[model samples]
Target: MSGQRSDTECRGTHEWVSAAPFRSHLADLVGTTGLPWRAVALYADVPTRCVRSLLFGRRGRVVRRIPARVAERLLRVRAAQLNGLTARSGDAWAAHDLASRLAGRGQSAAEIALLARATRDEAALWLVGPPGWVSARSVLLLQAACHAAGMDWAGPADPWEPSPAEAAA
Candidate 1:
């Protein structure tokens, strides 16, 4: 057996799963999550000008390195949407459903790479869950995949409910 442990065997016991996204992904995220640009700017505490520039590629070109603070705020906002009992909660369950549906259809992570235009490792992460954050681009791609495969993306329609730990606190 490989020395490395699989994500499955180590579920619910890992730490600091990276949620970092590209600045371009941030732009796509606005559309996927249906959050307004102004709201993202306000919530992320980033200037509207920067948000526009990064997202629209307007006023010249895209910024290579997003400011750390801005990236942090962006991540925090996305993370909060999925916030659950644990830090990495919300999207993990949604991802579980996607994986199951895909599996039932005899699809593989390689297919996810093609469907989502994500790298192999990225596709694997989606299948396994606990991604840093799910990009809007990924959401669109995964939805498209579900449509093409004639499968409904099986996820709850409601907002994330509080975890038991949270409810008890």
Candidate 2:
């Protein structure tokens, strides 16, 4: 299942196009932005493997043809569009803290996900785990909500901060 293409990826009703141009665009996008394929896919709202397969191929097999939707989507992608986004989801810890605070304030994970423009699963994962790859958009969205709610996300929360007495000790 790891190497398999999903039904949507394989069952595109649109005409398939030569993967060369899309491949070029993908390379350029990655190169210019220094963003990995996964980041670009997050911005594009497509599967990470879709970009990976087109850019690097799968299991030693090069993708000669690409689905029209994927091609068009990749073609329209620009490096400028990836601003504030990242591949590693650097703000996961912050997002996790925000979700926890919001949850404590009677906000559900689904509502928090909505505020972050992320899925509930993502919110739940952030809540349960320490920190993982969370998209920057989620952080930005949650940050905006926090700002509106008079909260700050300048850094790790107070509990995590080293106290002066602790430092002296």
Residue-wise C-alpha lDDT for candidate 2, range 102-123, written one tens digit per residue: 8777888899888877788988
CA shift of 162, model 2, Å: 52
Ten-residue stretch with the least lDDT total in model 1: 153-162
Alpha-carbon local distance difference test for all models:
0.51, 0.67
Each candidate's clash count: 1, 0
Candidate 2 lDDT (Cα, whole model)?
A: 0.67
Q: Kindly provide the TM-score of model 1 when superposed on the true structure, using C-alpha atoms.
A: 0.35
Highest TM-score against the true fold, candidate:
2
Q: Tell me how candidate 1 scores on lDDT.
A: 0.51
- Model 2, poorest ten-residue lDDT window? 153-162
Could you tell me the lDDT of residue 83 within candidate 2? 62
Query: How many pairs of residues in model 1 come into backbone collision?
Result: 1
